[model samples]
Target: MTKPAYIAITQHTKNSKPALVYVPTRKHAGLTALDLCAYSSVEGGVAPFLLGSEDEMDAFTRGVQDETLKNTLKCGVGYLHQGLSELDQELVTNLFLSGRIQVCVASSTMCWGRLLPVHLVVVMGTQYYDGRENARKDYRIADLLQMMGHANRPLQDNSGKCVILCHAPRKEYYKRFLYEAFPVESNLHHFLHDRMNAEVVAGVVENKQDAVDYLTWTFMYRRLTKNPNYYNLQGVSHRHLSDHLSELVETVLNDQVWADFR
Candidate 1:
């Protein structure tokens, strides 16, 4: 078979509404945006937003010190990631949402509840680093679904497109995984200490029992409660509850001043 091009462009929208290309890492996202911009046409001009008039676009372009990013912006492609400043992020997001930018290349962090009416979502990979697992892992089906959900806007007449590009080895994996919907697993354990500290400091929970009560109201708690078998918890037993509480309390006590609590 003939080798394919490094980058491919597919058009789904007639008006060039914003589209997202999701890469696995910040570096990949930046490189992809630069590649796309460098390969694409000037007719697909960049969008720069300023509080004032069109002249501000020139000013904004001049202000960007990164020559690569500045040039990419001129080509109507922008990259977004946690590394970018809040102002830069907002500028890219606003321009994309307003249909001024044709494509926004971003890492998977962009998928978390930041709704952009993108006409297409090109997911470049099926794996990401999992800090909890201490290794890279394939994305769960639920996460892929959530990411794909960003492609389509309910208000739009035309349905959006989600394309996942993976190596041949993982092709069957994605097929099987995406064939059926998977329920999202709880991740509250990751945030237990932070939530506990905030609730205690805010006086929303006075005691351990109050903390448990507050947690029970969370979606994670409800999922655990409803599907105890799935979690292997064997029901919301006192032992399991205490184990969770102990973990949270230990984390908080280690990081915070106990005397300040009173």
Candidate 2:
């Protein structure tokens, strides 16, 4: 006998009158909401699905003078916000797990470890870079993996029915970049040295001077030896930071500043 696949049911009512399409790109995120209004204006009866936060909905509702959007589409559109408490998370998860809301527009963060039955997953620009001081950082592959799990589920009648919409330029996007940011998890070293570089080197930094020296040498290697090659280690640059390093810096800096003031 075959094991049953994951099936979700909820008390949330489905709006079968229309379909909901979630967009990930900021350029087109609002298109679904706007198009619904446009279609409603001409068609007269069919309502379009609108997905946004309450604040977003409010702003668009107030900004647009379109009668169909303001009245009809606005009523059809649903708002989803991350301001949910733990209790609210359970409620929303139940709604999703139970298949209550027909359409939802959400950030990728919402997909992390969430059990929701979604018909589609859309990915926008994966290359989100942050420039801070003299550093540049790329979005983590772990972060992308977390979002991609939105489409993964046990095989069922509708389990493989999910569709992933990506940008035209990103037709092979996932293949190229899904594992870019997660070098360790993505087994990048295996790809580079074919398991020759799989060995992990452990060291003990006995003192603050040792830690600082390691960082200084790493900085020099990255600047002089590696040249254009980008290397980020904790305390070397804000570009890449581990949780412990971030906390340690914050604690030390705050303590020193406070002590100096006193």
Candidate 3:
């Protein structure tokens, strides 16, 4: 992955376009950034990925607290993870967008929340271990898409590219998912009863119609017609949707949680 990332860094740097690399964890983000930096360094010293003059590089690292991070930045590499302060995240992000940084390696959970003008994006790995689940989970489909999406810069470049590194068995899986449009479905129904109970207690919802009406204002309601079968609906008519919601409301009101409200 780093070999490809190294190639991307070298190529994109020549075009004056930023590149992005997505890793699975905070530790991976830092290490990958430094590894890429070293790949382009001169005689074991940080030499590639750096931007601007010595004085400018000196000023860039002056207030940065992490010594390794400071050095990485001098090499024009930045790492971001969920642990960073909001201000620090913003600083690194701004630098990347403004061409002050050549490459940024970020963890899956650390989305920069901005449209990047990068020409290359690399997904170093496809799975991360989840402590709570006690297992390794594939990167969420949406997250993988978002990470890859950064390779494009609408007006900045004529084209963009993304390299995805995953286990051999999962290559087909990613090819199918990434090349196809993955639909995003709402999960609001999973916790609708709890939410309905709260609104009922707060006098925001009174009966079945009120509950159904409340759902109409939610994203799930908007998707009813689009994915009626996913929600277990036999028909996609307004009446059918209303009947389902009414049934749901009745069921919720009978649950142990809503007993007191009734």
Best by TM-score: 3
Please list the C-alpha lDDT of all candidates, in the order they appear.
0.68, 0.39, 0.79
Instruction: Kindly list the per-residue Cα lDDT of model 3 for residues 123-191, writing each as its tens digit.
Output: 888899999979999988778878877878786788888888889999998888856877778888899
Model 2 agreement with the true structure over 1-262: per-residue lDDT tens digits: 0000001101112333212233333224344445444554455354323333445445544644333324432434322335434543454344344443334444444555455545444344444324354543433657665555555445522432333344466557665664355332222211322211122123434444444344334333344223223323344344444343344334544554587699
What tens digits encode model 1's per-residue C-alpha lDDT throughout 154-226? 7774687777887799998788776866577887766777777788889998876786677767787768766
Q: Cα RMSDs of all predictions?
A: 8.8, 14.6, 5.0
Instruction: Give the per-residue Cα lDDT of candidate 2 at 107.
Output: 41
Q: Which stretches of candidate 2 lie over 4 Å from their true place?
A: 1-45, 48-81, 84-92, 127-139, 153-158, 161-170, 176-262
Q: What's the lDDT of the predicted structure labeled candidate 1? A: 0.68
TM-score between model 3 and native = 0.68
Clashing pairs in 1: 46-76
Looking at model 2, residue 211 earns an lDDT score of 40
